[model samples]
Each structure stands twice: as C-alpha cells, then as structure tokens.
Target: MRKIAYSLAMVLLLAACNSESTDKSTAEVQTKQEVVHMEEALLGKWRGMIEIPQSPLEIILNLKELSGSISVPAQGISDFAFESIKYNESDVAITINLGGSLIKIAGKLKNETIEGTFTQNGQSYTITLKAYTETPVTYEKLLIPVAGGELKAALEMPDKGTGELVIIHAGSGPTNKDGNTIGAGSNNSLKMIAENLAEKGIASIRFDKRGIGDNTALIKKEENLTFDLYVEDVKAIVDYAKKDDRFNEIHLLGHSEGALIMTVAAQQNDVASLISIAGIGRPADEVLMEQLSASLPPNLLVESEKALQQLKAGKKVETVSGQLQSLFRPSVQPYMISWLKYDPQHEISNVNVPIIILQGKKDIQVTEKDAENLYAANNHATVHYFDKMNHVLKDVEGDRDQNLASYYNPDLPLTNGLIEEITKFIKQ
Candidate 1:
C-alpha cells in the first residue's frame, strides 16, 4: 500500500512539472483508492520532523475535510494553507500550494500514524507524523512592492535605532523568503541569517523572488520572465527602506545567484555597501558550463554549447535536446539570454559602494577562484575566506558529496564567521 501511494504521488508531481509528462497513464490510473476512513485519519493536528544532515526541522499540519495548513513553526512559518487534500485508496495524500510551487505528501496509515515522504523540486523528505505542540513566535509578514504584486517578505526588525537595514537576497529559483525552494532541501539559510542579524541590532528584509511565494502568480508563462524583473524587485525593496525612517543606511547582502543580482542592483540604488556571499565572479555562461560540463552526456553537452552561443549572442534557440531542456528549455531561454549579458567581475568593478567579497573553500558550486576573480576586478574590496563553510553558509568540512549532503541536514548551524564579519562591517 505504501509503495502504491508513493508511486501515484510521483506521477502527480511529474504531471505538475510538465503536464505532457509520459506518466499520463499513471496519473489517470491513480484515483480514490478509498475515501471514507482515510479522510478521517488525516483530520486534526499532525506533527513531524524532517531530519537532514545535522539539523532536524519540525513540521506541523492542521487539516479539516478539504482544507488545512502546514508550517515549520520552528522557523516561525505558521499556517501556510493547504489547497488540496485527498485519500488515495487506503493510503492518504495531501497537497499544499507553497506560493506557486506544489508540495505533495503521500503515505500509508499505520497504527494511528501516517508515515510518508514530502516531495518537492525532485527532493524527498521523510516525514513521520503523529500530532502539533507549542505556540510559535510572532514573525512580521511584510508586503514590499513589486511589478505585479507586492513581494511578501519576512522582516525581523531590531528593537532600537540601529538605523541600518540589510536586504537579504536569496539565491535563485523558487526559493522563498526563507532561502528554501522545491527540489533543494530546506536549509533555512536566509531565515537564519535574518534572525541572527537582528541579534546584532541589524534589521534585514528577505523576500520571495518574483514567480515565487507571494509573487508566484505574477508570471503566467515561464517564457515571459526576464532577469531585469528580479533586478527591479531588489530595487523596490531598496526604495522601501529609503522611505522608512527606521534605517539610514541600506546595504545589500546577497547569496549565490542573488549576489550577482545585487551587483547589478547596486548600480541603480544608493546603497551604503554590497556584500557578495558566495557570488560567482565570471560570466553566467562560463559558470554554467563549469557546473554542467562534467555531468552532461557527450551528445547533450555538444548541443548545449551551441544553444549557449546563440543565447550569448542575444538570440534564443528554438529547441533543445530533451535531456538538456531542464537547463536550456525554450521557456527559460529569454531569462537566460538576459542573464548571460552580465559579467559578475565587470559588475563588481563598477560598484560605487564599498564591497565585501566572501567565499568558502568547501563550496562545491561557486569556488574560491570566483572570489579571487571578484577581488581582482575590485582591488579595494575586502575579502574573507572561510575554510569550513559550504555554499549554503553551513559549516561543512569534507569532500563534495559529504558537504553537499548538509543541504538536507536541518540540525546543522550556519558557519561562525558570517555573522561576526557582517555585523562588524555594518555597525562600523
């Protein structure tokens, strides 16, 4: 019964990603296995924990017949409503619309417990449930203006007049204000940073990227998304901080892809400083090739190079190989074309504000070399290297696989140097 429910859930997930998925038959066949008793089993409050790496994050869900909400109360995320609840055979399944991304949980009931996996963005989390405990902390739900909608953000303000704010820019994809998205394990990197910054009397605002979280419904077609949209989104937040008298200095702190976006955004805003955390220092295309060249099939790699050249030339390729579609799909080419135009090195060189470049020797994604390149362009920038940190700012020491595994480890605390460095820089 467990196997059957899991299989059906996989089909549903695939269908959601690409409606024309080959699993059309599997999706069609997955129906109500039994509705009566299963629904009753899912009622009331449920509590579970996802154990990833050294961190264990707790989850709580409250469900009625057709509705309920799921939240990670530990991280101050409470009552994110669930849109779909269904009983598939003797097994049960529930779907939650996280902004626009859908997360599905499927499992079989055993001895008054529903044991299953939470699947999103091709990442699977083992969720063992029984029921909720403890009231959660109060986190301010802020609405910052954007193109089509006000990008919702989690704002943690300092008690007194630090008179400074750091806009925390999440990496990429559907990453929410908390620095988590589908497929990637929920590490809560950005959320942790904001909370930590508050302790140091520094306020921070972290928002969901457009087409994600509160802004998920903004873009109907993926093909219509552009890199400029994100740049504008960051600018909007800066404008908000400028108007609010709570802060006099507005600084930008971006991680991974957000780091590069901040470089471009800094040019348009009167920010006090820019902090690039694990930001790439090369052209987008070059960084992309380095990441994919080793993993892609020979034939697919050849085809990808051709498509990349067209994109770099400010043209989009009509078609890409099926295997390569995940990266170079027609729907995403427009944004890719817009993104490839920026050289992180060049952008950093042009920044009018003081810059701090950080790198982790253990990060498998953007290496130490990238940080060195950024320093080369901006010789006046302050550079810090952490030998213990990984890409997500987690304290991980070891080979690539072991370090990468920390993504799922909810118990692991972020590295030590980040807060100390940022606090000193901002307060100074």
Candidate 2:
C-alpha cells in the first residue's frame, strides 16, 4: 500500500509540472500575438503638422515593423531615421538626434491617429498624424566628388529646359541643402529659391557641405575644415555642372557665408555670373565682433575681441572661456582662421563675371551697408534691397519679434519681387 501511494504521488507531480509548462507556452504565444497586432496597427506612413508658432509645419513619419524614419518636406529632410522608438498597445515614444540636438515625440495611439507632443530644445509643440501616402520625388540626387569625400546634393530641373543651371550654396554652420539648420527648424529658404528658379525654366543644384546633413561623413574631424576647403567644394560643384551637357550656362548663388565662398570660387571657376544674398561685406571677424558686442559682458567681450584678433592673425587661442566655447572652440579655430583671411569686399572685386548683390533692409544680422560695400567693390555688380525682408529672405512687416518668427515659418513666401529680380538677372 505504501509503494502504490509513493508511485501515485510521483505521477501527480509530473502532471502538475507538464500543466505549468503548457500554460507558460500559451502565455508566450498570446504575448507575441499582442505585440504583432500592435505593430500591425502602427506600421505605415503617418502625416502630421507640427504647430509651431506662427506656422504649422508638415511632417511625415514612416514606420516598419521594428524601425522608422521621418521627413520634413518643407525643410528638405527625408528619410532621417529615428534614434529610438518605443511603443506599446496604447502609447508610443520616439527620439531623434539631429546632429546633436534631440527631438522627442510622445504620443497615444487613438484608433488610426497618433497625437503627440513634439519637443526640441525645451520647446513643445502639438502634432497629430494619420495614414499618409508618399508623393513621387521631383528632384534628382547627385553626389559630387570633393577632396575628402562626395557632397550630397539635389538637382531641381525645370519641366521646360532653359539650358541654364544655378548652383545654390547655403550659409555656414549645419545648414543643409534646403537651407534649414537642425535646431533652428525648417525655413526652406534655399529650397524655395530652387523651386522658384525651376518655375522660371532654370535648373538648380544645392548641396550639403562637409560635416552637415548627409555629407557628415565627409569630414571626420572638424579641425580639418577650412574656408579654402569650402571654396574647393564649391569649385567641385561648378566642375560637376560644367561636365553636364544639360546645362549651357552655369551660375553661382551663395547666401551669407556662402556668398564669400562663391566669390572666391567664381574667381577660380569659369562660371557665368555670381549672386550674393545677404552676404557679409566686411571681414568675418569684424562682423562677428560686432554681433557679439551687444550680447557679451564687458570682460568676455574684451576676451572675445582678443581671441578674434588672434584667430584673424592665423593663430589659435589655447584657452577659451566656458561661455565662449561654442564660438572659440579649438576644433573650429582653424576654420575661423581661414575664414578671417578673406575680405568679401576684396574677393567680390576679383570676380570677373557679372555680379548681383541682394540684401534685406530689415536684416538684423547683415546691414544695408554690407550690400553697399559689395557694390562699391565690384564695378559690374548691381544691388537690390528688399525693404520689408529679413535675413531668411521673408517679408516681416512688424517688430523684431515678428522678424524672428519668420525664420521658422516655411510656408512664408520669399519677399515679394525677390524671385523676380533673380529671374531677371539670370535671364539677362
């Protein structure tokens, strides 16, 4: 009787263990099914608008089963992959690293819509997304070979060929081919210019310089970048355009720092003409010093002036203040030193082609005097001033607050007559 009882207890223990295993397997399958269902609901293209101040910018999110990417058409950003994406049955969180800036989105999945708060650099904005379909691409992507690597560029050709191509170079910093900086949001000024030119039956090419946008891999070290390197890059683009049989006449258009680069590049390349938009006429060091004068304290201002002088002399300062690190950082000092060597006034005078100088009277960064200085230097240059236009080439009729607000407004049209003047210049 004791042996039979022991055998029955063993059998019961085995049955209990098998039952537990079966239950665990069922739970695992159910969990996987729930996850798959959530993914199915979340996958696809989502369209939304970021309710930024004064404007609503459209954004597109494309999700796969496990990964996703985003696009801002206004900013010319496409297929920028997400850094991290965490989602559950009811909620989703996304993080994107733009250069070094962080853009975070937290949303709740409600039926077919995803409503979220888009946060970047401490500013929060509302965004709502629904199912979307992507439009066909209108521009051609080109990789122009440079010294270190190739530049990622876009070519926008008009439907009607005009045999004229304008190469557009953006301003300094991390500004991309679309003229949008990472943290500054999308202004699409350059993109607008390109489209406007295309509408006028002119082809245009814009590019992401080294260490910016898709060309970030071009420069492994910031210290290696120089103003001369920028000029060479522009020359490379010019060379690329020259080789293309589609274009008979090649023109160069540069904004801000790009204006200086094109001025020097035009002297080297066989381009037809050059256009300078809101470019600094004075030495970059002088312009920078003037800009910092109002913002820095007396002591820091003095130090910054000294540092600028050293950089202008082709020397790097060994020690920089904590507050001034962004401007005087050692890695960027070499580029500054090379940039300081060029005087726009002197460089513009050397361009052997017809020159157009366009400036905005309301431009806070560059003054009307800058346009006048360039005109004074170049004998063949014609200058035009937009009375209501700001630095980003937008029409802002109100106070400084309104002027700044236009910088982030992609829908804001370029100042009236701005495109007409450019078209007239190119056609003439």
Candidate 2 per-residue lDDT over residues 1-428, each given as its tens digit: 12232232233223322333322221122121113245467778888887664345567887655667776643435556676677776677778655456678888778789998988767678988889675476799998989976788899999997999999989988788888764456688999999999999999999887766567566656689998998998888888888899999999999989999999999999989999999999999889989998899999999999999999988989999877877887888999999999999999999999999999999999999999999999899999999998999999889999998888788899999999999999999
Q: What value does the lDDT take at residue 35 in candidate 2?
A: 32
Q: Give the TM-score of candidate 1.
A: 0.77
Every model's TM-score: 0.77, 0.78
State the local distance difference test value for candidate 2.
0.81
- In model 1, the worst 10-residue window by lDDT is 22-31
Residue 310, candidate 1: alpha-carbon lDDT: 92
lDDT minimum window of 10 residues, candidate 2? 25-34
Per-residue accuracy of model 1 over 25-133 as CA lDDT, tens digit each? 2123332233555546666788776544223446777765555667563233456555556765447677765534667888776887878888765667787877545
